[model samples]
Target: MKSFDVAIIGSGPAGASAAFELSKSGISTVIIEKETLPRYKTCGGGFVFRGRKNMPFDIASVVEKEFHSIDTYFSKKHPHLTTTRDQPIITMVMRDAFDNLIVEKAKENGVTLLQNHKVENITFGDTQILHTTEGDIEAKFIIAADGALSPIAKIAGWKETRTIIPALEYEIEVPKADFERLSQNVRFDIDAIPYGYGWCFPKKNHLSVGVGVFTKTNKKINLKEHYATYLQTLGITEILSEAAHGFVIPVTPRTDIFVQKNVFLTGDAAGLADPLVAEGISNAILSGVQAAQAIIESNLDSEKAAALYTAKLEETILPEIRIGAKLSYHFYHQSTFRNIVLKKYGQFVAEAMTDLFMGERTYPADYKASVTRKIKEAIF
Candidate 1:
């Protein structure tokens, strides 16, 4: 059995970020990953500027494409609108490369990364013991950054409270002409599905085209049909590959509990994905850092660390998630109200969203007041 100060499960953005922070603080940290390094991860691969701003190191080498503006389409009938920023709005990178980069940085900071080790069972007692496929590990603290369907979280008896949504993505290699044209801009069609959106994000060599749906609503939407329609609308006639990747995304944060004794849940394992846009990487990294910070600040006191983590989440992440959930409910479920607001204040909303992505602003800080004002104005 190996003993460590912290045992982090999963080596995605969340795990790697936590390991990086812990190791940098001179904590004995070990990352247990189920897969080999640089394995392909299913994602749209669009990293928003908000995430980019928080990273401690530069990712310029891994960035495949950088977009200065986004083209948003409300529907096929309505003309698409463009939002521009002086700096790049989003940077596209393959998850394999991006995740590998972060893990390597953690390694540089003396983090022990054990690849191909899957956590099989976790036993709690005087000290937490993680039984993995390779062997067993003893750690003072456990950070479950495993993912949306986190086995560690389940083993800890944490009931899931977030909504899980289904998503599909295709990495299509188009012709040189089409690739060049599409690579110049990032596009999102909000009306591609009933309660979802379609995106075309260009990589250095391929385009990541995908469709996602918020399944909490009663709307019945065929994701496959919508994906095909989206490709057709984009004039992507030829797909070099036929294989499509499917995955589940957590769209809401878990409200029940994030910390239990010595065990702390971060990233998708904690259901920290944004309800409005379904983005997880930013919150993943944020939660990872906060988890490590809690342990460091509490001097490895598990009970105190757990309390601090919950307080931090309540002060920062949960508030934004709550507001986002409210906005998502209105924006997706109430279609008539959404259309009216967009039709009248489309530009203002677009700019505000762009600012939010850029970290220049946040979601309704006073959600109730803001919503009340909007409702009154709408009715008037």
Candidate 2:
């Protein structure tokens, strides 16, 4: 059996990022992926500048589009908001290429990759054994970064304790006129669906359009019905060619421990997608790095690594998500009040949101206080 200091399941952004960090530190790490490199990954494909700038290596080769400004339409609930910044607010990239690039970088740092290797089961002990269709490997620690439906996490004895919401995305090729007209800007239409939002992201040769229900709901939502409406809203009458895929995003972190025995969970496996926007790419990469760093800083001590990883998340990501979850609840449900706040302090709030996107600010603990102050001003 093959052995390493750490074994990572799934070669998505989180796993790839963790592999890159660990191998760079001269730690023995291996990435086991069930699919081949550059496989199709369903996502909004909007890589925000916050995540892009933090990447250690250049990824300009895969970037399809870069926007310095963004438009958000509230559909008459409030005034439309446009925000701009010096840095690109959102960078677009196809996930297959984007994820492959990161894995390649990790490989250069001597991380081993086993592609098309499906993990069948795991035998837990002080050193875990990962049984896969391809082969068996032993590692002192296991990092589960396999995305929303994480098999590794399940095998490690995790239950569904996170809030997961569904989304549908289409890679659409439209008529030249329609594509040209809509491809110039990135726009998000709020309330394009009930309790959800729709986005039109322009890619190099097509539009990546999707709608996601960002709030928690038990009622059924027909996403296709809403998607069709969104197409009409964007004036995309006909699609020359399109590929639609549906997936779920985990917006809240798991309430349980991130580490179990010798296993650690990162990215979607740990339910670390951003609560407000439901974007996982940025936090996926960040959490992966932190997990790897914890292992490294602990000098391969599993107990210390677990504690360090938890501390790392509590320091920022978890707290931010907690507040973001609360804010998202109100932002979607309290439309009347949200509109009131927006009407009075539209530009200020818009700028603040843009800053949050740019990583210039985190989810503000003082957001409530700021909104209270603005409401008083409006009332007076």
Candidate 3:
């Protein structure tokens, strides 16, 4: 049995980030990846400024493009909103390179990388044993940093309580002329889909276009049909090549425990994707760091690690997600009332959101109350 102080499942941003932090502290950290490094990960590839700003090291090498501003479109009800900043608001990256960079950085700090090891099951005890395709790994702590549909979480006996929503993304190569025009800005088209939106994130060689609806319903939603409509809305005429990928976003955190039997859950496994924008990378990195810190701070005590990790999340990530969820509900579901507010303060709202993405501002605790106050003030 291969033994380590801590073992992290999945080498996504969350897992790589945890390894990076743990290795810095000289913890015997090992990252178990089902595939080799630099493997493709399905994401829109928009790395927001907030995530970039908190990065322990520079990632300029993997950045494809950086936009100083973002454009948001709400057809007919309001004018388009463009928000700019002195710094890049969103940075584009191909996930394979981006995720590999972080893993490489972690390795530099002495973390072990167990490639091609798919975790099949885990045996819980004083030292948890991870049963993988390659071999069994024994570790004092386990961090489940896997994606939304975490096999690790399922094997760990977690029941599904997260509000998951479906998303479709396409890597499309369009005509040079169209790419030039669309690549000029990062854009979001609100109401392009029912109860959700469409986004266009341009990369170095292609465009990552997708449409996702936030609210879940019994009525069937055809996201492929919406993607076609969104392409027309974006003035995309011809697609020279295209690759389609479908995934789910867990917008709400699990209502159950985050830590059980010395195992800690982070990232999409814990359902920490931003409710408003469905941005997972930043929070994934954040939660992974927190989980590592908890183990380090607890001096490898399992009970203390769990408590500390929970405390850190409640203090930082969870509250923000809770508020963002509320805002998303109003922004997407209550279109009539939301449109009225947007018509009046559309630019202001967009700027605030841009600032949030840029790490210039945070979601206020009394967000709903503040918005209500603003609506009343405007009406009165």
Clash pairs, model 3 backbone? none
Model 3, runs deviating above 4 Å = none
Alpha-carbon local distance difference test for all models: 0.87, 0.91, 0.92
Q: What's the residue-level lDDT of 141 in candidate 1?
A: 93
The residue ranges of model 1 lying beyond 4 angstroms of the native Cα positions read: 366-380
What are the per-residue Cα lDDT tens digits for candidate 3 across 1-380?
A: 88999999989899999999999898899999999888999998888899999999999999999999899998855779999898999999999999999999999999999999999989998999999999899999999998999998888889999999999999999999999999999999999998889999999999999999876556678999999999999999899999999999999899878999887999999999899989999999999999999999999988899999999999999989888888888888888877778778888889899988988788888887888876876677
lDDT of 1 by residue, 29-119 (tens): 9999999999999888888899998899999989999999998888755567789999889899999999999999999989998988888
What is residue 360's positional error in candidate 2, in angstroms?
0.4
Candidate 2 has which clashing residue pairs, if any? none
Give the TM-score (vs. native) of candidate 2: 0.98
Query: Candidate 3 — worst ten consecutive residues by lDDT sum?
Result: 212-221
lDDT of 2 by residue, 1-380 (tens): 99999999988889999999998899999999999998999989888888888999999999999999989998765778999999999999999999999999999989999999999999999899999998899999999999999988898899999999999999999999999999888999989987789999999999999998998977899999999999999998899999999999998899989999788999998999888888889999999999999999999998899999999999968999999988898888887777777887888888888888899998878878876777778778
